[model samples]
Target: MILITGAAGYIGSITSYHFLKNNYKVIGIDNISTGNARALEVLNKFDNFKFYEGNFGNLELLEQIVTNNKIDFVVHFAANTSVFESTQNPLKYHDNNVSNMINLLKICEKYDINNFIFSSSAATYGEPKTNELITEDTPKNPINPYGLTKLIGEYILNDLSNAKKEFNFIALRYFNVAGASLIAPLGQFSKSSLLIKIAAECAANKRDKMYLYGNDYNTPDGTCVRDYIHVDDLAIAHIEALKYLKNQKTSQAFNVGYSKGTSVKEVIDIMKKISGNDFKVEMADRRTGDPSSLVASNKKITSLTDWKYSNDNLELICKSAYEWELKI
Candidate 1:
């Protein structure tokens, strides 16, 4: 059985569905703090899906779960993930992202759950020193508490792997993850500060206008550039990570992205074109801890694993997100 933490969140829920469709029994745990109940309702439709509404950090609850189920692999996606919010309440980020991760690691070690797939972020790289694409070899110098906590979690994993050769993990440092699931009616259900989500909200008339944070960056369009990956593509990466672990490959980190950069203005323009909405876009000051440009060098993951991109188009991604936004 596969254990999925934060399975009620956007990427987690979709990933759970993929695993369930593959005929794998899935055990999901969530705190519902920022998770969506609608996601749980959808997952519950699957006969092989068993869910518990609680924090993964709860050692007693975790013990109950591990003792009951024979968990083979763990896909961890639970954490506080806002760069802006991380800056505001650093303690919260450290406690939830760092402390809770440590607690979960302890449970994994005790339960002999050797294979782990971590939901890392590009934020761990902080601001890139150049405009070049980031690779797994890039220096990790996080600028925010959220990034630092994730970095710390990676370090802990590395340490654990070193101490116990039987323990292995793959950390996928995700870029901007967007889009909704194509197979189901599922999508991001929580309120978000992500550019695409906000733009979709405006396109769906859920919001009055969308804010363009930081338009004076050192990019071609003077806006922050991000490599947006479809959520299903990311979910596929997790499956590939599991395959790598099953093959007993060496533990390592891989960058997950399209290796193409899209500026904030470009994304807004695409959303406007796809949704046919002349949405109001107000220019705003740069948010804290946002990089000017962050594109990925996906050569490592593609060359090493059978991971292939299915939805790499920006227009299709925006349209999928807009369609889901209209439904929600």
Candidate 2:
């Protein structure tokens, strides 16, 4: 059986559906601090799925679930993901992201869960030194506490793998993850700080106007650039990672992205075009620690696994998200 932490959240819910459709029994857990309970409504339709609405920090609870379900694989996605919020309250990030992982790892060790998949982030790379593609070997110089916490999580995994030769892990450092599940119509329901979600809200008239953080960066449109991958594609990457781990005895990390960059302005334009609503956009001062560009080089994952991105097109991503926003 597979155990998925943060299974009710944006990425986790869709991932749970993918696993269940592929005939894998899944045990899901979430604290509901930031997760949407409605996402679990979709997963509840599957008989192969079971859920616990609690935090992963509870060792006794995790132990009980792992023992009862005989969980052998763990896909950990629970995290405090706001970069700006992490700057304000760093201890929260450390406790939720780093300390929580430490506790989860302990449970994994105790339960002998040999296969693990970590939902890492591109924030671990921090600001890009050059405008080049960020490979897995890129220098990890995180500028924020949130990124630091994820980087520390990777370190803990690496150390544990070296000491316990039986434990194997795959850390997927994801780029900007956006869009809703086109199949299930389960979109991002959390109060997100992401640009695409914000733009979608503005287009839906939930907000009167949207603020562009910075427009003076050194890029084609003088705005920050990021690689936006559809959430379904990311779900596929997780399945591939799990299969790759089952076949190999080594632990590794791979970048999950589209190998292309999309600027903030470009995303706004696409959302506006798709929604056919020209919402008011205002330019604001540059946010501290914002990078000019951060794109991924996904060669490592493609070469090692059968994972090929099927939905890399930006228009379809924006359209799917916009449609979901309208529904919700």
Candidate 3:
């Protein structure tokens, strides 16, 4: 069986549904610290899904689930992911993102759960020295606590794999993950500080205005550029990564993105056009640890696995998020 941590969160819930549809028995765990109750309600409809509402830090609870379910693989997605908040509370990020991962690694080692997949982020790349596509080989130089924690997690996995040959892992460093599950009717429901969600909220009149962190970046339109990959495409990448690990039996990391860059102003314009609502946009000073541009070169994952982008259009992403916001 496959175990998915943070199964009630945005990407995890959609991934659980994807696995169920593919006839995989899944054991899901989440503490609901930042997860939504509605996501759990939707996931409860699947017969192949068994959920445990608790943190992975509970070793006894993790032991019970692993022993009872015979979990052989894991997709870990639980962590505090706010870049700005991580700046204010670095210890919290280290404890939750790094220490919690060490705890989970111990459980995996004890239970002989060798196959593992991690939900990493492009934040780990920090400020790109160039405006080129960020390949997996790019040097990792995280600028904030959030990105540093994730980078440390990657280091721990590498160390474990080097010592234990049986342990194999795939760390997917995602760019900007947005949108919602069109098929499952699940959206980004967490109280997120992400740009797309905040923009969608403003478009829906839930917020007064959306603030652009910086409009003076060295890019087109003088705004920061990022590669926004739909949540559904990211879910597919996880499944493909799992399949690749089952056969390769090696530890590797891949960049999960469209290899294209979109500016902050462009995203706002797309959201406005899709929602048909002209919300107020305000310019703000550059936030600390903000990067000028970070786009991914997905050649590694695309060539290595059967993963392909199903929803690469910006309009589709905005529309899916807009529909989900209206429903919630």
| Candidate achieving the largest lDDT | 1
Q: What are the per-model numbers of colliding residue pairs?
A: 0, 0, 0
Residue pairs with clashing backbones, model 2: none
Candidate 3, residue 180: Cα displacement in angstroms equals 1.0
Which runs of model 1 end up more than 4 angstroms from their true locations? Answer: none
- lDDT-based ranking, best first? 1, 2, 3
lDDT of 3 by residue, 66-119 (tens): 889989899999988888899999999999898888989999999899999999
Question: RMSD of model 2, in Å?
Answer: 0.8
**Worst 10-residue stretch by lDDT in candidate 1?**
243-252
lDDT of 1 by residue, 1-328 (tens): 9999999999999999999988889999999988899998999999999998899999999999999999999999999999999999999999999888899999999989999999999999998897788999899999989899999999999999999899999999999999999986678999998889889999999999988888799999899999999999999899999999999658979999999999999999999999999999888898889889899999999999999998999999999999999888
Q: Output the lDDT of residue 62, model 1.
A: 95
Would you estimate the TM-scores of all the predictions? Answer: 0.99, 0.98, 0.99
Candidate 1, position 261, lDDT: 93
